[model samples]
Target: MTAAVRDIWRHPIKAHGRERLAQVDLTVGAALPWDRVWAVAHEAARFDDAAPAWAHCRNFTRAAGSPSLMAIEAEVDEASGRIRLTHPDRPEISIDPADPADAARFIAWAGPITNPDRPQPARLVRAPDQAMTDTDFPSISLINLATHAAVAAEVGQELSPLRWRGNLLLEGLAPWAEMDWPGKRLQIGSAELEVVEPIVRCMATTANPVTGERDADTLGALKRGWGHQICGVYAVVTQAGTIRAGDPIEVRP
Candidate 1:
């Protein structure tokens, strides 16, 4: 059976944090625009000029070992080209990494604090859409919240989609069921996403993006409870547009 649409999440910056929208319009032959459009990458990395790969950065990397990241919030300000990071008592940090000077300032402030051995300095790289990584869309990734909940219930614990790092979270389906929907098609808002591959689990999923901590039992839980830790599906945008929360998703069974 088709399912009800729940919350729609868009991560402006890959692997950092998510932004929620109510609804979006579908564009012609494209996925959501500017969704995961920018990525922060470590220096001295090479990408296949022809073949696209999922490129990630320390910012998007989770700190599950330190769940404190879940408590932080990031607000990206396009006008000033800065990211305002908030962590309760800590002062707000307006980060503008585009400028070499600004990037250096951010590196000096956040580097040792976040990871002392993560190289002495960090430079932010702008990864274009031409570059590809694990994300199946020019602008989208999908996860079934229902499936995640089922896995948690099966394993007897509370879980979060942070383990999967999906671009879109669709609720209202059965647990571990989205895995069976590969090769099927579903409609999100005005967008049509073709379920393609089964997401392979990784250490990134086990690490909390915020704290950079690890949870060894995380992947094991997925393997035991759901045959695999795959919680949602990936889709290449067959169509483009905006997708927001509460949109009725049409699934072709």
Candidate 2:
């Protein structure tokens, strides 16, 4: 099926906020630039910044664990190496994540929004080379709008693509077609990406992006409708190039 780029998003801080983008440069064998570059480790987390590496999602303060985090929005100032964060209930704040004092400020601001019953946020951790993506390897998530519509239909509610927290959004593909694309190659704009695997659904999908409340049974809908808890596909860039919204996308066998 023919498809085209619909939207692009980057989360400079994992599970904290999202930033919309019009265009981005994809490098071969790398995750999206500045995406999930920093993550807030919880008080109980064993994440060591002196020797940073990928840990389970539980180590970080996530929307799945704290629904309020879903409502936050973030913008990154590349020149200053700072992120400006905003939430409906809180004042806008900018913090330079690399600075210890600024990181402490972020922790203070995020403490209340975090689930009190669970581990509290303590500090921010940065990845050594690539961003701290969920997958062990560098990858970008692609969500098909048609598939999202299908899920929304099954759940009987209007769902937002932001709920999936994907990097690239595509349109004009059949529902569930992406589930069978693990070995396929997609040519998007000037870049080529190889489908790596299907992205498994998590509780984070149930949270409303605007309200930061659990309003949908997205995992249940995916299981009942598709017999699996999967929505999007993860792909790794094989050819470095620029990608933009409205760029044509073609899948190759």
Candidate 3:
């Protein structure tokens, strides 16, 4: 099916906030730039601060564990290495998570929204020249708007695309068409990426991005409708190039 990019997004901090983009540059064998570049490790996390590496999602403060986090939005000041975060129930903050003082400030700001039953947000760690995406390999997630619509239809609610937390959002494809993309290449704008696998979703998808509450049973809807709990695909870039919204995407042999 023919499609074009509808939106682009990146999460500088894993599971914490999302930022929209009109254009981005994709590099071969890399995740989207600044996407999940920094991740907040919880107090009980098994992460190495001195030697930061890619740890599992369980080691971080994610929306799945704290639904309130889903409401957070972010904007990055790349030149200043700072990020501005805003939530519905909390005061807006602009801090460089890498700084000791700023990290403390952020931890305090995010403390109330985090799940009190679970480990608390602790240190902000940077991934070494790579992203902290859920996948072991650096991946760019792609979500189909048609598939999202189908899931929304099943749930009997109109859901925000932010629930998927994908890097690329595409439109004009058949519902669930991305499930067939594995092992195929997609030519998007001047970039080409190989589809690796479908992204198995989690409870985080159930939360409402606006209210940060579990308002929908997205996982249940997916299981009931498709017999699977996946809504997006993971892809690794193969060609370095620029891509933007409105650029055509075609499945390649």
- The 10 consecutive residues of candidate 3 with the worst lDDT sum are 122-131
Q: What lDDT tens digits, residue by residue, belong to model 3 across residues 1-253?
A: 4599999999999988999999999999899988999998999899887787888999999999899999999999999999999999999999998799998999899999998999999888877877999999999999999999999999998999899999999998998889899999999989999999999999999999999999999999999998999989999999999999999999987
lDDT agreement with native, every candidate:
0.57, 0.91, 0.93
Residue lDDT tens for model 1, 1-253 = 4565666655554444455556756555444543554444444345332564455433333333223334345666657767666654355667665677866665454443343434333444555443233554443467788767766676566666666666667766776667777788877766777777777665556654445455435677788875666656667667665576777677776
Model 2, stretches more than 4 Å misplaced? none
**Cα lDDT for residue 125, model 1?**
50
Ranking by lDDT: 3, 2, 1
In model 1, where is the ten-residue run with the lowest total lDDT?
57-66
Report backbone clashes per prediction.
26, 0, 0
> What TM-scores do the predictions have?
0.76, 0.97, 0.98
Per-residue lDDT for 193 in model 1?
Answer: 75
lDDT of each residue in 1-253, candidate 2, tens digit only: 4589999999999999999999999999888989998899988898877888877777899988899899999999989999999998888999999999999999999988888998999999977887888888888999999999999999998999999999999998888788889999999989999999999988999999998889999999998997999989999999999999999898899
Q: How many backbone clashes does candidate 1 have?
A: 26
